[model samples]
Target: MLITGADLAAPALALLDDYEVVFAGKAPSPDDIVALCRRHDPVAIIVRYGKVGAAAMDAAPSLRVISKHGSGTDTIDKAAAAARGIQVVAAAGANAAAVAEHAMALLLACAKSVAVLNERMHAGHWDKATHKSMELEGRTVGLVGLGAIGLRVARMADAMGMRVLAFDPYAKDVPPFVQRVELDAIWRESDVISLHCPLTADNAGLLSAATLAACKPGVIVVNTARGGLIDEPALLAAIRSGQVAGAGLDSFAEEPMTPAHPFHGEPRITLSPHVAGVTADAYVKMGVGAARNALAVLHG
Candidate 1:
């Protein structure tokens, strides 16, 4: 069996004892991937969502299954795989809790001004009362998508004494604590806005300048989901104009953000290296799930 992407190597290896595992040195080009597959002719291919492309599929005629290590299949060409009779599967819901916890961490960090306060302390300046910190209690949190991760965030926010309002077109009945509302209401009424939806063509720039303008002034925004969901330029402008009080972002439209990125210099923003779902526990669960899915397809 072949596994692309280094992030999935260790956990996948732990779950599979019978197969001889081969790891690509780096994200191989389409030609390199096809060449490797022609040489190996493995029964199954496991790859990170964004690393594989059409060339790899055209190269490997023997490939039966393409398993994704994570939930998002944005990087994979599903139509091509379907045409080729290839089965695609993902380890969905494996990292929901970890992601939800990380989202809340960002929210709390923004609400309490954790990054700014830490900087002040490091500078040897005692300014406790200079920055006013608000508690999560009595705040209204609007969740963009009430999937597993969003539902978990809603529960946590409720426990913290925050009223939870969620907007998900697919959700038929929300939990008791969460009030299901329209998308416009979520945008206008939320004190803190937490995004938990996937990035799609329809929702790619869901939080653009126009939408950000509709948000309540001084709104604290948290995005642990994909970065393209929020328009970075709009977010930067909102932060500068004081329309957004603060932001917590774990993902970016581009990875390994450039040093010249506008959000880099913004003290009101807390950034993470796309690590919201990278905890040890989540890694193990996802790895095991991927391995099991691959084995089931290969043996069936």
Candidate 2:
């Protein structure tokens, strides 16, 4: 077995005690992965970072399974793996609590201007007389996906006395508090729009300039999902023009964002280093799930 990152959680490592495992170091590039595959010819890969494509698969002819560390498998080339009879699996819902909590935190931060207020206090300025935070008690929150994370978010929002609306065609038997709605309704009536969907070919730019324009003015946007879902340039323009009151983002179209990125100094946009699901507990859960999935395939 080959693990793609620097290390796996100790609990997960314990599960693989009977199997020989190798680490590919931290932040391995595609070429690096291929080189490691050629050297080790691993039977299974527990992917924690970097991508696994046809090149890497071809190098390791014995490769049988590619298990993702977390729910999203967008980084892996599923089509390529399929062609070679290599199975691809994900630790689905392993980080649900962690990610859902992060989404709620982002939504709250954007709604209340928490970051801006903290910065103002540090600068020795007080604008309490002029500042008014938006209250979320009665506002509506629209969720793009109703998966494990989204369902938890909906429950949290509902507890805060907010109306919950979700748009996921595949979701069934959702909580009564969450109303199933169309994307149009999400744009038209939601005061806050949160994305929890996967990044797919058809919905790469789900929230484009046109979609952003259709949203209610002063809408707050929160995305803990893939950044490709929202067009970055269009989002920046919307924020600049005040169409989007504020945004809380945890991911980007490109990972390890460059220092010169446009959102670097933007006050209205709050950014995180794509670590929404990186909590200590979630790490162990994801790691264990990934390890078990790989073992299941290798033993079968």
Per-model C-alpha RMSD: 1.9, 0.7
lDDT per prediction? 0.85, 0.95
Worst lDDT run of 10 residues, candidate 2, spans 17-26
Which candidate leads in lDDT?
A: 2
- What tens digits encode model 1's per-residue C-alpha lDDT throughout 1-300? 777755564666877778877666555655666777777876777765345666777777778888877677766678888988888888888889999999999999999989988998999988866767988899999999998899999999999999999999997668899999998998899999999988888999899999899999999999999999999999999999999999999999987688888898799999999889889988887777788888889889
1-300: candidate 2 lDDT, tens digit per residue: 889999999999999998788998989999999999999999999999999889999999999999999999998999999999999999999999999999999988988889999999999999989999999999999999999999999999999999999999999889999999999999999999999999999999899899999999999999999999999999999999999999999999999899889998899999999999999999999999999999899889
Indicate the worst ten consecutive residues by lDDT in candidate 1.
46-55
Report the number of the highest-TM-score candidate. Answer: 2
What pairs collide in candidate 1? none
